[model samples]
Target: MNEVMDVIRLFLPLIVVQLLLMSVALFDLYRRVSVRGQKWVWVIIIIVINLLGPIAYFIFGREKSSEY
Candidate 1:
């Protein structure tokens, strides 16, 4: 039980952060008009790729201001 608690304590913050990031990404994805590529593709990437998925969406998926 101690070992399990230790593991959970260490990973709990990460899980929380990951969920937060994913939710924000999904929300942003839903609100945007156009991203760098297909909306469905970004949704799949955000849902399936874990932490990096949302980061990737922010870094590469979103279009530049000049694009609009």
Candidate 2:
């Protein structure tokens, strides 16, 4: 009860940030043409690895382009 509520409150911000990061990562993945690896693989990674997944995609999966 109270303990559960406290735990949720403590982690709420982290959960929100994770959702935000996943959404942004998925949006970028949908729009971009050239990811560093297979699109499906990246999608799995992003959804499965929680916090680190989207960050990994943003840092490593996205291919650098001259237009950037």
What is the lDDT, from 0 to 100, of the residue 51 in candidate 1?
A: 99
lDDT (tens digit, per residue) of candidate 2 on 1-67:
9999999999999999999999999989988887898999999999999999999999999988733
- Alpha-carbon RMSD to native, per candidate: 2.0, 1.5
Per-model CA lDDT versus the true structure: 0.93, 0.94
TM-score of each: 0.90, 0.93
Q: Estimate the TM-score for candidate 1.
A: 0.90
Show model 1 residue runs off by greater than 4 Å.
66-68
lDDT of 1 at 22: 98
Candidate 2, which segments miss by more than 4 Å at Cα? 66-68
Error of 1 at 35 (Å): 0.8
The candidate that wins on TM-score is: 2
